[model samples]
Target: MRIGITLTDSRGPDALTRLRDELADAAANGMQSAWLSNIFGLDALTALAVAGSQVPGIEVGTAVVPTFPRHPVTLAQQALTTALAVSGRLTLGIGLSHRIVIEDMLGYSFDRPLRHLSDYLDALLPLLDGEPVDVRRETVRAVAGLTTPRVGRVPVLVAALGPKMLRLAGARVDGTVLWMTGVSTVRDHVMPTLQTAASEAGRPPARVVAMLPVAVTDDTEAARERAAREFEVYGTLPSYRAMLDREGVTGPADIALIGDEKSVRARIEEFGDAGVTDFVAAAFSGPDAARTRALLGELATAA
Candidate 1:
């Protein structure tokens, strides 16, 4: 599997600089890709555009940019622009987010997310391919075309977990970018459902990019405790909770790759064995951060 790392979640005045250095270091270390999340702080696509402009060796992507807030046309435009800025190396990962965040926080309904994704892709894909779009589905409508130069076709991946979402992703887009999901879940549920749909649709094999917290340490219990504390919110989220249940794990910490170097390396290999195309490590080892990074770099080089 191709190995990658997430950008540091550093905020404030030096966040951009820190991310730029991280990207450069990853490329220099032979990492295949670097992923950025679109959460609260800086916009992920814009940040990647700026940071990625200087480092053109490794691929850059968003773990996800939510589709609710931005129109399909607008997002296509932005993604294309960012792709151009980054030397045609942008994989646009998008998702429905969650009902709590969409309704309570953003004041947008999260109803019928599968249908929304289908409609959103219908509009967004064509625009990204430099074609005219005139689709008007129930959840999305785009009747415009972009004049931007083609920076190759921007590959799209959806953050999918449930069956419907996976089927839609396999049929409509390139693949799925997963988080809080384990190897067993990917092997039993994700691969079967996604690959079948892609095959039925006459598409090529789907890509599965798995993102999980990783730590390299001998103190297993301490690392597990730290992961439990740092990533508690994911255990409560319904979609992630469902995957945790499917993996037959109690919480987020159970799926995390935490242990000594050998154990952690073995766990990472398990994901590749289960058909993961790429493994993006979200290292959260605190004091062991540098050690964890060194391991990831070594693994990336080996991969």
Candidate 2:
């Protein structure tokens, strides 16, 4: 399985510089890819364009950019430009962000999200492939094509959790990128649902990129407590809550990979054995942060 690390910005004065340093460090440590989340902080695509230009040899991607905020045409344009800037190393991950963020925060209607994604991709995919887009669907409409110089088509991954989303992802996109999901869910529910949809669609086997908080430490209880506190909100989100339930786990803490190096390594191997295509580690070992990264780097090199 391909191994990578999720890199986040601190939102500090030198956030861009720090991001560049982090990318370089990840590459130097032999990581195959580095990913950033598109939250309320820095624009992930733009940050990667600037910082990733300075760092070579490691692939960079967005864990996800919410599809609600940007029109498909505009996103296609930006993603294409970013892909060029990053030397065709950009994997664009997108999703229909939760109702709370879409409706409550962004004041956009979150009804019929599945339809929105279907419509959004209808326009977005053609544009990314350097073709003219004239799609007009209920949730999205685009009539134009991009003028940006062609880089290779960007690989798109959807942050899909439920069966419907998984089917949509498998039928439409390259693969699915998962968070707050466990090995059991990946082995039984995710792999079956996603692969079956892809097979029915006559597509290649879908990639499963599993991401979770990881910690290599002796204080397992403390790590669990920290994970519970830091990632508590995910357990409350309905989508993530469903994944937790499907995994037969109570909360995010229960799904976290936390223990000494040996235990943590064993759990990660379980993900690979369960058919994960890529394993992205969100290291949160606090004082043992360096140690955790070292282990990830070692594993990545070995892979």
Candidate 3:
């Protein structure tokens, strides 16, 4: 399994400046990859490009960039530029963001998202493969191709939850990127469905990138309470709520990896056993931030 660390959350004008330093720290400690989350602050792809150049020997990627706003043509250009900056180390993780963000926030109609995703792949894949995308689809339009001598195919993983999206990821893209999904959901729902679809399409096995909250702390209850406060928004999101229910979990704290060192390490191993190919650790509050980071560094190697 591949082990990656989520760059510690930073939201400020200095966030971009801090990203490279964070990635440098992760790579120095033992992480193989560093993932950046897209938010109102730093642009994830841009941050990865900057971080990747400075932090050698560590893979850098966006946990996801939303697909609704950027056209496939522009998205392809941006992804290629970022990969070029990193010497082909960028794995583009794209997604159809929640309706709250898409229609409610951005004011884009969220009509037939599954269809939009299908149309998106049809246009985006060809561009990544260095072929001219001359077709127009219902949700995307493109008439361009990358001229930046294809160093190698930049892997694409879609953030998916439902069956149709998982199948779509398997059939077209390299794999799926997940957040707040549990072991049971991955084992019984995600893996089987994705594998079957890729197999039927005669494609190689698909990748499963799972991201989870992790905290290395002796005060389990206190850590859980802190986690409950920090990541409460996810519990209310419909897609995340469905997955949590499937895991028999009451809240995000239930899936969080919080315990003494040994127990925390064991929980990470459980994810590997459940068929997660890549584990992204979102380290939360602990007694000592430095100690927590040190523990995550150890788990990252085993991850």
Candidate 4:
């Protein structure tokens, strides 16, 4: 399996520099990919452009950027620009963000999310595929000029969870990015649904990219505490809650891979056995930045 690291979207003064250094370190440590999560912070594509130039070898991807805030045409243009700047190393992961964030926070109606996503993909896919897109639907309508340069084969992944979203990912996207989902969930719930859909469509099996919090430490309690604190918000999110529950976890502490090297390695291999094509580790705890870097390096090599 391809292994990677995830940069947290923490909005602190040192976040950007830390992300850059992390990407450089990840590339140096032989990681195949480096992913950035877009929650409520800096633009992911812009960060990718910067990190891409600095780290020449590692693939740069967004675990996801929400589709509700921007039009599909605009996103396609932005993604293409980032892909060009990165020399075709960009993976554009887009999604319909949660209703609470879209409707409650952004004040946009969350009704008909699947339809909106379908319409958005219908227009966005062609634009990314180097075709002129003139699309009209109930939610999104766009007419694109044929003047823009095309970045060939910019892979688009989707943050799909439910049946409809998984079907859409199978039908239209290169892969699915999953968070907080355990190996069993992937084996029993996600993989079967998505793989069946892709098989039915006569397409290759969709890549299953699993993102999990990882901490390598003999100090299990401290590591779990750090993971719990960092991942607390996800536990409360309605979509994630059910997944967590099924894994017998109430919070991030319960789900995170926290233990000594042997235990962590075993946890990671479990995902591989569950048919995960890619593993993105979000390291959450250590003695310091140096220790965290060291652990990441070890995991990269071992992975």
Candidate 5:
């Protein structure tokens, strides 16, 4: 399994610089990939582009960028531009963000999200592959007049959780970038669904990249408290709450990987056994960034 680190876009003032430094450090420490989250701060693609120049070898990816905020053509163009700038080292992870965020926050109608995503990927994939895209659908349409640098084809990953989306991801996209899903969920639910879909579709088994909160410390109690506080908002969110409930976890502490080196390593192995091809550790809230980095470094080396 490939071991990676997730750069948190949720905090710090010099986020871009910090992300660059972290990627460089991770690369130096022999980590295979580094992923950036698309939450409220710096855009994931832009951050990856900036970090790509700084760290040459490590694979850089977006854990996800919401699809509702941008059209398929626009997103395809942006992803291609970033891929070109990075010399084809970008993985574009796209998703239909939750209804509450789309409807309540952005004031966009949330009906037919699955259809929207299907249409978006159909239009967007051809564009990324340098094929003329001329498709008209209710939610998405693409007129193929634009040209990209054609550096290389950027791999599209779907941020998928449920059955329909996971099936779509297996059939259409390269992989799924999963968040807030535990190993049990991945083993019992996600892997089987994706594998079956891929097998039925006659495609290679879809990559399952698991993103989780990780805090490596002997003070497990303190780490759990910090994780619970840091992930408070996610615990309250409807979609994530449903996933947590399915995992039988009531709080972030239940999901977070917190312990000494041995225990953390065991948790990572558990994820691997559960069929995660890649593991991206988003270190939990803490005072010492260096300590977190060191812990990741140890894991990377040991693995």
Candidate 6:
């Protein structure tokens, strides 16, 4: 399985420099990729574009960018531009963000998210493939196409959790990107459902990219406490809640990869055994932040 680290950036001029240095460090430590999240921070695509200029020998991508705030045409344009600047090392992970951030916070009607995603990708995919898009859907319409200087292949992964989204991702996109979902859920629910859909559609095996909070520490209880405090909001999100319940986990901490080095490495191997294509280690906040990253680096080399 491919190993990577998740990056959450604070906004500033120094962010790009920090990302460049981080990518260099990751490459030096034998890591293969860096995943960035677009959760209320600098634009993920643009940030990656700038950082990719300074780094080499490692891939970079957005863990997820919300689909509601931007139109499909605009996104295609931006993604293509970023892909060009980054020399085609861009994995675009997208999703319909939750109601709390979309409706309550941004004041946009979080209406028919599944339908919106269905429409959104219909336009977004073809355009990214350097095809002329003329889609006419209920939630999205596009009559755009990329000009010259197109990317060869931009692998797209959807942040899909439920069965419907999994089916859609299996049928339409490269694979699925998961968060907070456990090994049992992936083995029983996600992998089976997605692969069945892929079989029906005559597609290749669907990619399962599982992003989990990870730490190498002796104080497992303290790690859980910190993970719970830092990621409590995810526990309240409805989609994440369903996955947690499926895993019989009451909170995010329960699903975290926190333990000593031996235990952490074993946890990562567990995900690989459960059929994860890529295991992206989210640098979970704790007393051993650097230790966690160092372990992830070592594991990447070992893998």
Give TM-scores for every candidate, taking all chains together and pairing residue i with residue i: 0.98, 0.98, 0.96, 0.94, 0.95, 0.97
- Candidate 4 has its poorest 10 consecutive residues by lDDT at 288-297
What global local distance difference test value does model 2 have? 0.92
**Model 4, range 1-303, lDDT digits (tens) per residue?**
888888766568876777788788789988889898777787999888876877787899998999989988889888888888888899988888788999999998889999999999989989888888889998999898444566678898999888888898988788799999988888888898898888888889899889988877777888788888888999998778877877776786888877766777788888889888998888775774455456657666776
User: Residue 84 of model 5: what lDDT?
Assistant: 83
Is 1 or 6 the stronger prediction by TM-score? 1
Candidate order by decreasing TM-score? 2, 1, 6, 3, 5, 4
Task: Candidate 5: list runs displaced more than 4 Å.
Answer: 10-13, 287-292
Residue pairs with backbone atoms closer than 3 Å in model 4 (clashes): none
Off by over 4 Å in 4: 10-15, 288-299
Once fitted onto the true fold, the runs of candidate 1 whose alpha carbons sit more than 4 angstroms away are: none
Error of 1 at 49 (Å): 0.2
Clashing pairs in 1: none
Report clashes for each candidate as comma-separated counts. Answer: 0, 0, 0, 0, 0, 0
Q: Write the per-residue lDDT of candidate 3 for residues 214-295, one digit (tens) a residue.
A: 8877788898999899999999999899899988999999988888778877877887898889888888766656766787
Better of 5 and 6 by lDDT: 6
lDDT of 1 at 275: 94
Which lDDT tens digits does candidate 5 get at residues 170-257?
9888889988888888998899988888888999989988988888787888888888888888888766776788899997679988
Question: TM-score for model 6?
Answer: 0.97
Instruction: List candidate 3 segments past 4 Å from native.
Output: none
> What is the overall TM-score of model 4 with all chains considered together?
0.94
Q: TM-score of model 2 relative to the true fold? A: 0.98
Question: How many clashing pairs in candidate 1?
Answer: 0
